[model samples]
Target chain A: SAVISQKPSRDICQRGTSLTIQCQVDSQVTMMFWYRQQPGQSLTLIATANQGSEATYESGFVIDKFPISRPNLTFSTLTVSNMSPEDSSIYLCSVGVGLNTEAFFGQGTRLTVV
Target chain B: GIQVEQSPPDLILQEGANSTLRCNFSDSVNNLQWFHQNPWGQLINLFYIPSGTKQNGRLSATTVATERYSLLYISSSQTTDSGVYFCAVGGNGNQFYFGTGTSLTVIP
Candidate 1:
């Protein structure tokens, strides 16, 4: 099992502002995933951050909106740029030891745009 | 992308009751896991069964990869069991898709 810690458990940001959420893992991982969970909705994959390379984002999400930085195997950050009311959601970070192994998640950063 | 669906989106169970949650995937998968997200939004790993049955104290899960479905069983449910349960499936890649999730409410 992997242990993941995400910063800013909850935050309220003004519209048009930007906020960065940090994710730290207990061990080094090759890939880190970011997800968004809107109010009363299921989780949606935002992007996959790979160290030493660009992040792979899912459809309906872009780097300009949610840029990711994977500085190393144990740390990554997801920035929500120019936030809006619709962007208010819980952002989570995930990592897996292997492709076929069980994945672990952070406690998640709850961002509320006001 | 593999589509994942979960049945009984919302469940209300009495304390000490037993319940079963199902997860169905559209394609074959090499990884299947069940998670319980508490009210505080912490996802707790429950099982990592990809093709067999596994048990833990009061929780158990069975994944029939060939059948493209998995079942999670909770026996003698407690109030602490009230939360959203999600099943995530992955194919050959590291990308895992999550199900719609089952919101369980265990009343005392």
Candidate 2:
């Protein structure tokens, strides 16, 4: 199994500010995914970050609001631009060795917009 | 896109009891994983059973790829087992679709 480390386990930000969450994996992975879990709700896929290529965002999510960067296979960052109260949620990054393997998740960054 | 559903949204059990959690997906998937989210909000991967069964300590999971459903069994539950269990399925796109999760509370 791979180990994932997420930075700034929790953060409090102003409504107009932006918070970027970083995810680091111990091993190189081909695909990294960003997900959001709203308060008391299930998780939703934000985007798929592939190394050396653009990220693929899901429905109702736009790259302008949730910009993602996958500069390399071991690291990825997700920035919540112009944070709002509605944007306050838990963001997590996950990686799997391949389609046949189980994916591992970071501890997650709990963001609170005030 | 695929739909994932989990049954028994909330569950309460006594310590040392046994419980079963289920996950159903609308379509076939190449990846299926079970996770437990603790109170501190950490998503812990419990199993990566895309198909067949696997066991670890007091936890075990079985996924029927042909039927698009999975089952997780926890034997001799403990207070520390209280948390939310989630099931996620992934396809060719490499993005996972998550279920609402089953919340379990084990009382001492």
Candidate 3:
């Protein structure tokens, strides 16, 4: 299991402002993913951040709204651009070491847009 | 795209009591995991059981891949166990589909 550290545990941002959440893992991981959990809702996958390329976002999610960057194997960042009140959610970063291993998640960044 | 559904969306149990949570998937999967998100919103990995059964302390999980369902058994529940339990399923890809989750409230 990898230890994932996420910054900005909680933040209150004004609408239309952008916030970049950082995720750093202690050990190098092959797969890093970003997820969003709306208030009282299940988590939804935002994108899969590749080590050196653009992220592959899931359906209903696009790069313009949630741009991602994975500069290395152990670090990644997800920026919520042009945010809105509907964008307020708990964003989480997860690291999966292998196909059969458990994916570890960061503490999650709680964002509230006002 | 796989669909994961969890049963008993809301549960209230007494401390020291036992409870069972079920996760059902719509398609075959290569990976399945159980996670507990505490009230503080920290996601804790409880079990990574893709198949068969695995136990840790009072928590046990069994996954029947062919049946397309999994069961998580919590014995002697604690007040600290009050939270949401989520089950995620994935195929050969890195993306996972998460269930709606079971909200458990263990009253002390």
Candidates 1 onward: DockQ, in order: 0.74, 0.73, 0.73
Between candidates 2 and 3, name the one with more favorable TM-score.
3
Worst 10 residues of 1 chain B by lDDT: B88-97
Q: Over all chains combined, what TM-score does candidate 1 have? A: 0.97
Task: Write model 1 residue lDDT over A1-114, tens digit each, in one string.
Answer: 789999989999999999999999999887789999999888888999989999999999999999999999999999999999999999999998777788889999999999
Tell me the spans in candidate 2 whose CA falls farther than 4 Å from its real position: none
Better structure of 1 and 2 per DockQ: 1
| Ranking of predictions according to lDDT | 3, 1, 2
lDDT of 2 at A111: 92
Q: List the residue pairs that clash in candidate 2.
A: none
Candidate 3 RMSD to the real structure: 0.9
Report the error of model 3 at residue A27, Å. 1.4
Please estimate how well model 2 matches the true structure, expressed as its whole-model Cα lDDT: 0.92
Runs of candidate 1 with Cα error greater than 4 angstroms are none
Candidate 3's residue-wise lDDT over A1-114, tens digit each?
788899999999999999999999999889999999999999999999998788999999999999999999999999999999999999999989886577789999999999
Q: After superposition, how far is residue B17 of candidate 2 from its true place, in Å?
A: 1.3
Docking class of 1: medium
**Fnat by candidate, in order:** 0.63, 0.73, 0.63
- Scored by lDDT, the top model is 3
Question: How much lDDT does each candidate structure score?
Answer: 0.92, 0.92, 0.94
